[model samples]
Target: MEPFTIYEQQMQRKLTRWGIRLQKEPNLLERASKSIQNRINQVIPDKIHTTITATVKGIVQTTLFGITYMPKTDPLRGVSMADRDAKAEELLSLYKKIAAAEGAGTGAGGILLGLADFPILIGIKLKFLFELAHVYGYSTHDYRERLFILYVFQLAFSSAKKKPELLHTIKNWPAISQTFPPAADVMKQVNWLQLQQEYRDTIDFRKMLQLIPGIGAVVGAWANFGLLEELGVAGMNCYRMRNLQDKAAELADK
Candidate 1:
């Protein structure tokens, strides 16, 4: 099968596994994914000669055996020069290939991003369900930030070649679905200590979590998910990947 078809099939399995249903309407996640790809492509310098320049001038005779030469030049549009444009175009094309390579390297994470707001967006639809979990005396932690984090983590971690079991954990979710706390339960006092502690602890865990090779994506996804909640998903996905790409590049250099 063609690569795109294979990707589609794999993506479908992931969405289905997460219990996120894809609709016939415009695919926001797909659009966001493309946007990320575009942003990633921007980091690469498309041309090298664009930075260099040369100028020419005339010479004036000062004395019998002495002459002074001066150079006067008009600046040309960098891209207008043949050498610059050719180098830039070639570099830009190569950069695109590199972006594709990095993207291919990020397996499940790519799928999750493509799914867009799978967990969080779907969570909005299932708000009642999460609230129900809390009202019935379940720990609200999982449904709130924890669950949100889990979903984002799924997005980030999913992109690695060595897929994490967490994806599978969330996939066959029924086994631990009830472990999530409900809204009412979260509002209660009995479980405050544990959840509060967990909340505080997760802050640090997030830092450590993001450093892991495959785990960076999960942490990133969770961060994005939280940002989406704070700032709409569209806004969250908008500028975040550029920051991520830079960080990744910096790390690669180290």
Candidate 2:
């Protein structure tokens, strides 16, 4: 790895601060929100909850395992990290607009169309992560790399209470990922129920408001835009951390 320039050092400092913030414990309001979300979950029928869990699990499983789509390798492999990140920011901007449009269209259609937004948004988010991986010069062709993408997804959508552990896992991914089994086995290892519950709890209230008659359109557009923005930040930083660590390791060896 090349030596870090003065600008890179400044960026690294900013990233370190962000990492610390990511691992901090949830505040009181966040805890209260989680409690309220749990109560709402209690009132939802077991059957509906089970269905949603199964649906989400299946969507993720298919995305990871299915042959329907494969991410193209990045053409900018030898480019500087700064250059790659600039391209990544452009991609994020494009996807943000796409997500907001999708959100607005579905949100204006009331409950049924609002339901359709779930899978569509998931697809957009996952596709963007695949592209982000490439921009960072990582190959998603490897199942392990793909698994890292999933961890990034979880880190973005997970509740504040769950963020620390996920952040830690991501930080140590280079070592921890080695112990992972084959792709099929790794898929089975996922706790679908927990994954679904945490994700739903985090977004359900705002999404439910997207089902409302009159204001659904505005709510949906705003919510989707914010969600993608959060994911973009998390994904970029996760990759940035990996790249910086690799550079540091290379320098240490020299």
Candidate 3:
């Protein structure tokens, strides 16, 4: 057997384990966390929530509707899923380090950088996810593909209630993507407000600690590193699911 083929088999096995975990119901601990998070959210000032939501909306709108550099996914092909993911991880690692460094610097400044701070991290995550889409051989030029990037993103940072549904959308993305026509406006189907709210609410507390003066730097680096790590896991496995399932379909027809 060829080396590439052997690596692919190993990846497929890992994908199997990832898939099982994806669909498993959230346990009691997760539910309790959600409750606590909700209580915390209720205590947060509405102004902070509004500001975060607006900032996210601005970036997300620009990223989704703005002109893109890549031509299309068809022109970009990888030798194998394993190679693609290897490249993906390389890019993800670089991004994680960059975010950590930025976090450390900003964190040292304390709450003085509070509002300005998170947007930088948010921008980093957005850039990384869009880049990760390219690594998966998807065109950032297509709105639908950008939408898919957000889906992977939400899976990483969203409340547990949203994960299973997002996972389902990812599992069925091939069909869903096919549902969109060249001129179709699918953005209406998505709740933009909800998307931003989920993202902000999820990170609000942890990121708040990143604004502290004394301990802020350490918390910032660790928090930012973990955030990217979470996104990397969610992003890679999401793409892996599509690749493995598509391969299964190919073999089934044979």
lDDT of 3 by residue, 140-214 (tens): 877888778878888888877787788888989988878875523665556766777678667766787887778
Cα lDDT listed for each candidate: 0.32, 0.86, 0.77
Clashing pairs in 3: none
lDDT of 2: 0.86
Which regions in candidate 1 have their CA more than 4 angstroms from the true location?
1-148, 154-162, 180-254
* C-alpha root-mean-square deviation, each candidate: 27.8, 1.4, 3.0
Please provide TM-scores, in order, for all candidate models, with all chains considered together: 0.19, 0.95, 0.87
Model 2, 1-254: lDDT tens per residue? 56986766877998889978877888999989988988988898999889888888887887678644357565346777788789989999999999999999999999999999988888889889888988888877778888898889999999887888998998898899899988888988898888888877777877898999999999999989988999999999999888888788889999
Provide the clashing-pair count of each candidate structure.
13, 0, 0
Residue lDDT tens for model 1, 152-218: 3233322222124334443434445466566445333223233222222223233334445665555
Q: Residue 48 lDDT in model 3?
A: 70
